[model samples]
Structures are given as C-alpha cells and as structure tokens.
Target: GYRTLRENDTGLNGALEIPAMRRLLPDLRGKAVLDLGCGFGDFARYARAQGAEQVIALDVSANMIDAARALTDDPAITYRHASIEDCTTAPAAFDLTVSSLALHYIADYPAVVQRVFDSLKPGGTFVFSVEHPVQTAHPVGWVRDADGNRLHWPLDHYQQQGARSTSWFVDGMIKYHRTMETYVNTLLDRGFQLRHLAEPCPPAEVLQARPDLEDTVRRPPMLILVATKPAKRK
Candidate 1:
C-alpha cells in the first residue's frame, strides 16, 4: 500500500502534503531541511523549491533511494540510503526534519520521532503525515454488494491504539499504527511543542481525477502534524 501510487512517487499524497507544506512553509524558507523517509524525493524537492537552504532526503529503501537519485541531481539536495532509526546525522544539525505519510511505517515510531527531535537545532521544526488510525483499525475488505457492484464492511472503525495491518510488503515487512493522542504525547515527551495538527480535506480536483476513490477526497484520508524542538538548555 505504501509503495503503490502515493504522493511521493506520484503526487497523490500531495493533496495532504501540499496543505501541510503551505501551512508550514512560512517557517521553513531559507532553513536547513531534512526529509525523513523521503521516498523518491518529491517533498524534498518541494522544500527546496519553497526556499529551504538545503534539503536531505533519507529513506531506508535502497531501491527507492536509487529512484530518487535518478529523478534529480540538484546540489542543494542530497539523498541518503539509511533507516531513520540508524542515521548518524550530526546532533542539532537541521532546522527542520519532515516525514510525509511515512512515520507509521516505522515499527517503533516514538523512538524514531525522538531521533528526529534529536537531529534538529533548538526550535527546529519537524512535520509529518500518516494514514488515519481510523483507516487502519477498521479495514474494509472488498466484496460484492447486493447489486453485485462493490461494498465495504465495518465503516468508521477506530483503533484506540494498535497496528491493524501490514499492507506494504517486500518479503514480509512490519509496520505500525498509533492514536492521535499516542502520537502527540510521544512528541511532547521528546520536547517538541505541538504547532499544527491537520486532517486533510482533498479538493474537488483530486476527486475528479481519481473517481474510483472519490470517497477519500470527500473526507480527509490522513493527518498532518508540525512540532518544534525546544532549544537545548545551557
């Protein structure tokens, strides 16, 4: 699911990302930026275009990193092939570190969030997007309806806190899910102050293009968050 038809590879998630970027860009221009799980470098390039001084795109997937390198050769952007949990980036090196629709894929999300927190300078920003826990908790299996068309069961299922599926696979990969409160608290505990929390409302343009899943466009499909690291104490 994550590797298929997403905003990173194809701008589908841009509906969710563009809005978060619009809201967060004012603070991002001319700052050092890092993109966690950067995919094929879409948002990293987007950050550079929006005026970030430098952008580093990092993801655990080597194939994905190779795909990213092939797409762009800008000097301002660097692509790193490494797991976010294991990167040795200098402490407090970035003005901002962001992940778009990527954090939930990490098995231990809170630890990695802290790692991202530790990577930034004082007051540096970290923004990210993830599938709605509600989407994960109550999954709809495709089946034939009474009219023999299409229908889904268990609408509006909310996971209080859990991982419901492992849809994204490459020889059996593991992933996770977290409630909004679980997510927010992890950042707060790591010294980040919540700045913005967004539930996307995909525009009519997106619906018109992807008519099959207009349902996602009619109601926001994901959540975005922006949090800031406090400057280190003397």
Candidate 2:
C-alpha cells in the first residue's frame, strides 16, 4: 500500500509534508542519521544521497521493512524492523533524526520525544511532521454539499486526546490525537530547543498544477517542526 501510494506520488506526503520537512532539515553531509517510522525508505535513501555517512531506518511493519530493503541497495543505509515505542538507540549516536508524518500514530508521544532526545548528539536536529491537530482533532472525512463538493472541514473535540480510528488504505487505521500545546511542550520539557514550526500549504505553482489540493489551502493538513538537542553546557 505504501509503495503504491509513494510510487504513484499521489499522497500529501510527496506534495506537502516532505517539502515542509526538508526545508528545516540541517546539512546531512558526513552526519549520522536516524529515520523513525521510515516507510519505503524514502527519507533514508534521501539522507544517504545528501551525503549522510550512515542511516538507520526503522519501521514496525515487517512488510514495510522488506519493501524498503527491496527498494534500497546501499551499504550506508540499514533498514530495521522495529517500532519506535520499543526501539532503543545508543545515546548521542546520531547527528539528525527525522520522521515524516509518522509521529501521530504513536501513542506514547512523550516517551518517543525523550528517546529521540537521547539518541541525538548535542546540537543534533530532529525534524518531523505529523497530521495537524486540527485535522486530527476530528478526523472524520470532509463535509460535502449536495453535489459532493467539499463545503468545509469540520472541527470538534479539540480538547480530546487519544486514539482515533479512520479508514485509509484499509479500515480502522488508528492515529493518536494531541493538542498543539502538548507537542511543543513535550519537546520543551525534554530540553529540546524549538527551532521551527510550520503548517505548510502547497506553493502557488503546485496549487496551479494540482487544483485538487485547493482544499488543503483552506485548512492546513500537517505540521512540520524542527527541534535540536541543546549542546552540553560549557
């Protein structure tokens, strides 16, 4: 399913989230990188192409790991079948860690944040994207008019936080919902320096080319952020 969506380039990840996350990414040359929830090894391959010395990519799904391995043939990139919740990393082992639209699926946000902090070298960057809280707050599909024209995105249960099930490639896919405040504060509590936060929309040229994405302009669909582990106190 992931390979189908990615190969077709029909998902929002290719059009929006990846661009937004890439803008905030630090230089990868000679850096050690980690990719959490890496699907199809896109980011891992990109990191290696950017000159990263090594990349460790992990995903919970064995199928995804197998697919990634099949798609990749790089000595510097290692794909592991593991869940972010259960995986542990050597302290200060990586110069950068990245997740693209994957964090929202994890229920233990704080624990993951702590692990990412621990896994990064001082001043190392973590860049990730998740479904925007507004989208996650109420994940019911778009409200439509009589002709099935999308009227407006709905919003409710903003304060509620927990697992939300919705149909994606299959039925009953679950994603965790948390407030924007929770996301930022969790990083802050773990001593990460907040560097950038973005609710990005497709650029004008993209919108012109793919008019179907106009609804995304009306309400942001994803949030991308950058946080850095503070350098050890001098």
* TM-scores for every predicted model: 0.82, 0.96
lDDT tens digits, residue span 43-97, model 2: 9999899899999999988999998999999999999999999988899999999
Q: How displaced is residue 232 in candidate 1, in Å?
A: 6.8
lDDT of 1 by residue, 31-108 (tens): 898888888888788788878889988999898899999998799999999987777788889998888777777778
Q: 76, model 2: CA deviation in Å?
A: 1.1
In the order shown, the candidates' Cα RMSDs to the true structure are: 3.4, 1.3
Lowest lDDT 10-residue stretch of candidate 1: 7-16
Q: What ranges in model 2 sit over 4 Å off?
A: 9-11
